[model samples]
Target: MKVPFNSKDREVCIIGLGYVGLTLAVVMAEAGFKVTGVERNNHINDLVNSGKAHFLEIGLDARLEQQVKNGNLKSVISIDEVESASVYIITVGTPLVNNSKTTNLEAIKLVSEGVAKRLKADDIVILRSTVKIGVSRNVVKPLLDEAGVEYKLAFCPERTLEGKALAELVSLPQVVGGLDDASTMRASDIFGFLTPTIIRVTTLETAEIIKLINNTQRDLMFAFANEIAGYCDVVGISAREVINSANIGYPRSSLALPGPVGGPCLEKDPYILSEGIKALKGNPALALLGRTVNEELPKVTIENIQLLLDKKVTSQEKLKFTIAGLAFKGRPETSDLRGTLAIPIIDEIKRILPNVEIFGYDPACSNEEISSLGITPCGNLEDVFKDSSVLLFQNNNPAFEKLNLNSLSRLMRQNGIIYDLWSQFDGTSLELSNGVRYGGHGLMYLYNK
Candidate 1:
């Protein structure tokens, strides 16, 4: 891919400097393009201008600071401050509506209208927000068309993970789709500065559906694993053991581990996809079912914890529960708590056992930050284990995986219960310990023993 124009001469203005937008802005600036970040929030604008990222992600702070110092990137509170740019990218959030599964596109609409007001001829406009299918053609295109501007439009959905955004932005193949050939080519040329591989699709809707399908498929696989884990619990078998044994040297099967599937993307994208399918008069039964299974996981987890507590602990009021890991996902760790299941789990625990004392510990988050979420924060692992009657491993953080269970068991109350949601530890062997009673989501043998 040859450079269509001098990269240093191209100015890229990004709308909505949230997690996705801020990271992309930093990457583009680091790639040698003069970048302008538009943010409506005064606090966020101040934070960005001061070279500090509002959220936690690996390597984002250092990179953002460097970009700000280099003068390659600057932020403004109003879109009017964006005088001119070769490319305009909309990265606004599309959150779910209140008490509904449907996507709320108010931010998208506002940003599109804001961009349209400053539209210029021959400029490239790209949307990187994850939205419902047909959003690009039906919602955004009409707004820009009404503005009477001659510009190339494209939809390039963001696929980078939360913690690994900077690395993946440069490594992963960029997916590009546009209204026409010229639009697609221009978008590809822009993204080519960051990554060598650019996947050009046929239509804008294809690019939109690709992001929806990618996330929904993963949600379905996780739902299957969770369903199997529930069945294993009923039949006195280990779902983790069955899945591992079933997949060993097997080319046909790939089963995702059963855990809480709530995240910013997985929790809402399936609903958006299902809604789009319904609008087309199609039945999205599988998508809806997957959402139900994953959404109900926190409730199911609380029910199992109640059962385990009833079997071991005699007094509910005296129970002291300590939870580990608060973030949504663990592998590519992050401090983002959007759509996290840990909060609901804590709420459910309080609803069921109001007198119980709950404390949470996550290395990714600070103690004050955790406390702000209505959770009592533990200063250290020692503080979490001491005198706690129940230990619930909620998130699958690597630090929790490396914990010495035998040594920690001595610090807890005698015959204390350890509820492992991620199957990080062998619950079967823990049941043999005299000091601790072990139980996992799929460990039915623990219930029997």
Candidate 2:
């Protein structure tokens, strides 16, 4: 196996068999490369070795199985199992340090050490993990340099949605920036085989900022929409209505609808962006502001629910609150719940409300998976809303939109409230029963009054 670079060895080692690494390993193997994936987690390694994906993606499991059976790809718990490889790609998680603004680079550091132990001259080391600026040079470089071996290093970020990783990985333009021009060319040459377009940036820091800025800007957009919702709540209006009307055939003001903005990257990248900016003696005011707004959206929305409940429900003994669409997003539909807004909303509900029975339902997750969120798994649509005090829609799963809520609301307690974060249903078509109310996320004020 030979890559376009002046290297005959096309053996590739991918560290961390998570979403990023696993998808990349399979794709690379499909491209006629002998790929070996390394994961420290026994469970993930076992699953990958058995040709299964731990989480749900559209067509990941089938591709994984084919790759494994063909002997083109395999997963090992340690990199020492591999004799040698021309390319080593690190795709580990760079989660925040104990829910703080700083990124925890322990995974990146440890993987770098592992790659260094098996270091070879002219080997290409690509960092696909999200990190703050200067990490590629300051963190990974020193560790690899200690091996006294020459290697090409680059920062190539992974920018694909959870449910659409495989397709997008091959279609999306791969951004590659390295410590030197030769390193950048080497990375671009390898990634060029995956996608038709290759974005060659000047420096690793430039490539690092691209991912953070893209996600932070998206967070800021949703924050503005949530702020509009707050304004509408105060003035007795609908943020969804106003935004939809404004953006209708209008290109100037492209406003996103108000909803719980939570996913792994969107929830975490703003902090990484601000941290990078602050390190350079600059204030990322807008980025951090957006982060704060999105972070508080769930907590504040739950508080509003508490206010709405206080006026409607009189019985406190057997109160039942149901949550539908538990995943982070519902459009593409996924089972991943890493940075979901459900966590904070549940926390606020438990903290402010008393003795409430919380029911969980998801179109994309199993009952056991829903129970992992610390709520009772709802059997079905009817069971979820049966005698429930409040029904909250967290994500925009199509299952919620197809339901006849008018019939379901008939099963709820009197003055029952259905609040949709994505505003899938138009209240104009809903006919209430027993004083039941169905309202969009931003128009909760209409019913709370």
Candidate 3:
């Protein structure tokens, strides 16, 4: 693709300062564009204005502060800024509707409505959020028509991991689709600053489906990993070890270690795709099944704990458990617990053992944040282990790797269970410590053998 516009001089306006929008805006500003971030909430506005990031991204705050101080980035709570921007990108939330496959695109609609009203001729509106396939024409373009504006429209869904978003934005190739050739040209030109390897689809629907398919594929793979873990549990085999050993021969088919696949995008995108298929009068059983398996993992992981502890029933007040890592992914050290698998597992714990004194200790989580979720904030690792009857490890953090068996053994009560979600410690060492009981997705293989 050939660049048509002056990519370096483009004034980029991003709507919604969320994990997606905020990162895109910062990266654009860093890429030498005059970036204007339009936010609706007062709290988000305050954070951005103060040069502080609302969510966790690797080095996002320092980069945002540097760009803001350099006069390259500025945020405002207004749609009026659209008049100055030649490119408008939408990166709002598309939440799931409880157990249902449908998505709530209210944020997308509102942004489309607001951006449509402020559209000028030749200005390109790019939908960066994942939505139903027909959103570009059935929703966005109609709003622009209703506003009586002659503008270009495109869908260039976000394709970056939470922790590596900044690096991937500049390194990964982008998928773009526009209403017309002219629209595609304009979007391609602007995005070329970030990556020149752009794949243009024949229709906006294709672009929308492409993004959905990418996440759907990952969701399915994670589900397979979980099912394999289930089999490993039954056969007394370590699924992680088996997977690792298998990778030595057929390296291409290696899936991520079995864990909860919870995060805003991963958990929601597959449902949206499934819902779209349902609307088209097709049975999306496989997609729905993948979602079910992943969502059920946290509960299943907890169930594995019950069997290991050999406790039929327990009170919450007497039980103290700790979740090691909080962020969905392993890097960038995020504080975003939204749709995090830990939320559901913790909720299940409360339901079964209402009196269990649940203690959450994540280096990324603040006391106020954990308190808001009705959990006691244990700021230190030692506190997490102090007299706890049970310890639950939700994520993988290097801090958990530093603990010695002697240190862990002294922290628990007699015959106390250690629920290791990420296999935080050496299973053999933990089991040999005498008082400690080790349980995880596939820990049975190490000791059961």
Q: Which run of 10 residues does model 1 get worst, by summed lDDT?
A: 1-10
lDDT per residue as tens, model 2, 1-449:
23444445478899988888888998888877788999878988889989999888878999999999999888888989976698999999999985566999999999899889888888989999999988999999999997788889999999988888888888999999999999999998888778889999999999999999999889899999998988887788878889989999997989988888888899889988888889999988788888788889777877878887888877668789999988888978798888999988888889988679899999789998888989999998899889898999999887887888877788999998888887788776678787888875688765844
Q: Please list all clashing residue pairs in model 2, or write none if there are none.
A: none
Instruction: Give candidate 2 regions above 4 Å deviation.
Output: 1-9
Clashes of each: 0, 0, 5
lDDT-based ranking: 2, 1, 3
Best by TM-score: 2
lDDT of 3: 0.78
Runs off by more than 4 Å, candidate 3: 1-9, 81-83, 311-317, 431-434, 445-449
Runs of candidate 1 with Cα error greater than 4 angstroms are 1-9, 316-318, 429-434
* Candidate 2 lDDT score at position 390: 90
All candidates: TM-score: 0.95, 0.96, 0.93
The CA lDDT at 203 in model 1 is: 99
lDDT against the true structure, per candidate, is: 0.86, 0.87, 0.78
